[model samples]
Target chain A: MAEMNRFTRDHEWARRDGELVRVGISDYAQDALGDIVFVELPQPGRRVAAGEAVAEVESTKTVSSVMAPVAGEVVEVNAALASQPETINRDPFAAGWLFALRPVRVAELDDLLDETEYRKYVEELSR
Target chain B: MLRTPLFGAHEHLKARLTEFAGWEMPLSYSGVAAEHRAVRESSGVFDLCHMGRLVLEGTGVAPVLERLAPSRIATLRPGRARYTVILNGDGGIVDDVIVTRESDTRYHLCVNAVNRERVVDLLRKTADGGDTRVADLTLETAQIAVQGPDSAELVRPLLAGADFPAYMHTVRGEWEGQEIVVSRTGYTGELGVELFLPAAAAPSLWQRLVEEAVPCGLGARDTLRLEAGYPLYGHELTESVTPVAAGIGWVVDWSRSDLPARARLERDRKAPEQLLCGFSLSAPGVPRDGFPVFLDGRSVGVVTSGNMGISVGHGIGMTWLPAAHTDPGNAIEIEIRGRRIPAVVEQPPFYTRGTVRQSVD
Candidate 1:
């Protein structure tokens, strides 16, 4: 099965998994925030709209928010981040996923950018 | 923006550059946390060329320094350095400086980069009628710090046969035919040596030292000093706040009557209303500057300096509180992002396993 990833302008990535969607920040986001020391995740079963801040990532000197990519009910969150926040800096795409959500409107995923578009967007931002 | 002589060296090391105090300096090389740990466990090197350096010469230098500062300066022995502050007429701290008596008529002062021009102008005005000469050497010189438990071992081979100065003392030596001054003084609570050399000779020396020592930046330096309980100039020590409120009144030599802020300092020393105090959060949270501090649900003050206590594995910071609430074990709340964190007023030096006074082989 091929995996699909859609990105938001805020640098979060939402991957569709049939009825559920897993969310995490992109590599650029993790790199910008060096050496993550702590993470605050939203509680399971909480509903959030697109662009709502659902999680927080803290570095040695800065704090950044992880926003929800689309409207959904959070089903699960990665609890391991409480003890090992650096996991985000190590594997931001796979094991560092923040939470899983059951989307209220799966069609909203189409509004986000694909891998190619996100790469171009990031390049333009750096310039 | 002003660039240091070692800016090219920092770029070569892929440092994260940022603007600070009108200078483009490196904020971190590898990572702030990693560099901080390196200084604690092994060794680290830092480029401090952005700081202001000054040279004062002539017989009038001693009198001018004694009059402008609260600490005794005229009788300071050669090769000794004392941490003191320049004061305004109102007894407020103008700036914190390290005054090193180089000779009977020569002195070296390291000041904060942001206040360089102000300090130099003030000194020149005060010395107009005297025979003293104040020279701003900031642009012509460079300073580098090698710090940690293994600092001495790393620096000993470079200056072979030269006597290692005791803590708070300075030693003059030659490195690779270039003149240099090594001082056993640092902001971090570690066994460290700060090297003062000519600007043109800085890159080569920095490259040589970085081979064995982790190249650090201002990020780690800030955390290291905070853990050591040292106050930064603009944060804890400011023009409006005197040394008495900042918990550094001991720097004042009260017996002397010729000090500039003698009367105001004495009155504040005798009856202080509020004083700077240190605190640590009961939970794991990062506190930041300007965060409001509360006592019994009433706002008392704001955090002057705060950060994640890297060595202690918690949050630590400093703030002003009522004189009665300045004691250790008092409970307070630090508001972080609209959430108040339960904290307790504790004595500073939040991380105490330092090797500043230890002997290294």
Candidate 2:
């Protein structure tokens, strides 16, 4: 079976792929943000701690930070976002993945909520 | 947060609501980009009840308004409207407004929402010893705008007998057996009309318009106005920014002998230190308010308002630059998020394909 995705309260999602982890904002977050105009990603090799802001997403109305779900060093970023940021709004998963990271502590993944729990959290937020 | 008369309509449309000027207003119904394109291409409707409306009447009303506003009111004929600015004694702008001459003795003033109370107090104080009476009609009235290339067609069916008002004109007419005041004026750079009716009638009227026009929200309104190069009161026309520096000096009636702020405006007109100019970013990043503008790596000014203009297909903004650098084609740079992006000074309306001045039969 494929790796299951986990989410943070800040709306970031992380999915392990072999030795690296792929991260991006959840669909719920992108819909709330309206349209994504620009995305500023962290440079490769930059280390980030859990809950630390690793990227900035600007919409027509406002700008919001995308926090890291787990402590890791960025290994690769979505270069295509600089030219077309709306991909995130169109598809918040798969092709719109923000970056790949090598986690400092693999056990930190357990701290994030599972997909089922994330759905519940988002439903409660809408209330 | 305060809700407008059409709050139920917005809720029914499943619009995303945001607090603006203490009112719970729609930020977007479908999406900002889609709503913006709808206005540019066809038709869009907006709920503008958050804007303040006030009426001043009596024989002395014209003179009282003339004394308080930078624009000459005595020359405005009935059924006509003039976009003017209210100014402080020191020549700073209090609010940018559209004053419509309803009759020889009565005038309707449309002021910004945030500055509503301040404008009302100023008008009341100026009319203190005169026969003029000021009344705040904001809460009792509801306002909506239908804008785009097809605006006239979209609104004509609803208007019973009164002809569509000419541009910059107002006409009173009956719609669905209720009276309303329609003005051929709007913030978007499109052929449009604004309807003012009883607060209770707003929801139904909104539903009628939305059936034919896209329901736009504040997000689209901002982008549309930015493309038109119109200034928002708080962003571009602050208490400290004069109309001269804001590039709205033409609104001042210099020929009027008794106009307020004339002397100061005249002085600034001769040598405006900083004036508003438009910039189109050649780089990728979007410029935002308060972003530092540079020339030759030295900071020269700051952006007053900026956005990714959907019609222009690039980042465009207005900035208060030194008068020396206001010429179109001048090279400039805006620092957005620690990146100095290349930009060029340009004249506005940034998007020229608008139908604002299209002739109506």
Candidate 3:
């Protein structure tokens, strides 16, 4: 309803699209992940609650789970990113969209902080 | 916190810090997986100054070590090094060390830093043969290992393209107005070199090499050794352990006729109750130290070293399996966080891809 950008403290981002929101990991998340070598995405049309583990991305040395940003139904998947996941490192904003969701509630995304607050959240994590 | 001579250089390079065996050392700056892959594909540099070095001098140095160690030491030629274990009276291991014959009657032995105090105590007790003198020189000396497939090529620049010779061999080289003993040896299972130099010269040499090549840290060092199946002390060895149990009896010279007084231990040559073997998980689970290993639903062994093998692309570990379950190719399970994960047994020297032995074969 307001600005389209919403971010999670864990460094995930969700963008409002009609009744749906497209979700993916943030640049800070990728930097911490170091070169991602594998991705296990959530199945399309599956229902996921907020904070639920929706997917997993493993770099060469670390294996981390991606949490859902808001309660939602998986609408579409980035099947191409599974084969060319380095896109997450190259063009994280565009080619790295991990998944799309038909949000169960529009107001829940507002609970996520804005970009500036998200930046501070990540800065704390680095320390 | 005791700092190595290269400590300032590590900070200058923006290296990530971690606590390892009571020393603050660089875990990585170029990233763990990146540095690991560099060692596999080319070369990487490591600051290993925390290791302890002890020099023994006198007429009976060889005779004293003959009784103190599990192997015969008199056979080592001048400038040659041999790996052996300093065993306690009951045949239990104290520490596995590399003793270099510096001269006909002098020796330079490298011991584990964490075990330095205890090792020195043992050395003092065993050095009472009347003619032997032991000097703890760890604080004055430092060591660095430059390892990988292209390590010889990179080190050639310093030595004018001279070959590293063979394992357990050392060559004298001069750098930064310092005389350094360059050894054609390393913990990583690759064609590598170890430089023993004064502590002050360590930082400059570390930066100079990394400025022109790759700067690695403890993370790469651990993973590279794991990939090579070389056992870390805390992981695969301890005071109560024996070399035969860990699968390193090859250094014991069991068949030599001139066996020292320590040869009395061979009477009970039955391998220990637990056997050390290589293991890889069936799934994506990290089996850390102290994780119990099982066979047919019963606990039979424990993981001593575990991590993701970046070069081979799998989760790997070293485990002390009961001799009954120690056969290679056998299936075992590691209990990671209360979950039993499947693993396969493998022989040692795990990642043999770019090792020096590969060249001869």
Model 2 TM-score (B-chain only) = 0.98
Q: Say which prediction, candidate 1 or candidate 2, comes out ahead on TM-score.
A: 1
| Candidate 3 residue pairs in clash (backbone atoms < 3 Å) | none
DockQ, every prediction: 0.63, 0.67, 0.28
Highest DockQ against the true fold, candidate = 2
Which candidate's lDDT is highest?
A: 1
Q: Predictions ranked by DockQ, top down?
A: 2, 1, 3
Model 2: colliding residue pairs: none
Clashing pairs in 1: none
Q: Report how far off residue B85 is in candidate 2 (Å).
A: 0.7
Q: Cα deviation in Å at residue B17, candidate 2?
A: 1.9
Candidate 1, B1-361: lDDT as tens digits? 9999999999999999989999999999999999999999999999999899999999999899988898899889999999999998898888999999999999999999999999999899989999899999999999999999988988886665787778998888667898799989898899899999999989899989999999999989999999899999999999988887788888888788777777788777878888899999998788889999999999998999998878898889999998888889999999988889999999889999998888644
Model 1 RMSD in angstroms = 1.3
Q: What TM-score does chain B get in every candidate?
A: 0.98, 0.98, 0.93
Per-residue alpha-carbon lDDT of candidate 2 for residues A1-127, written as tens digits (9 for 90 to 100): 9999999999999999888889999999899888888888999999999889999888887788888888999999999998788899998988788998899987789989999999999999989
Where is model 3 more than 4 Å wrong at Cα? A1-5, A16-24, A33-48, A53-65, A73-102, A124-127, B160-163, B255-271, B283-286, B290-292, B335-340, B358-361
- Residue-wise C-alpha lDDT for candidate 3, range B280-336, written one tens digit per residue: 877765666677888988987678888767777667899877777778889999886
- For model 2, the stretches where C-alpha displacement exceeds 4 angstroms are A42-52, A70-76, A102-108
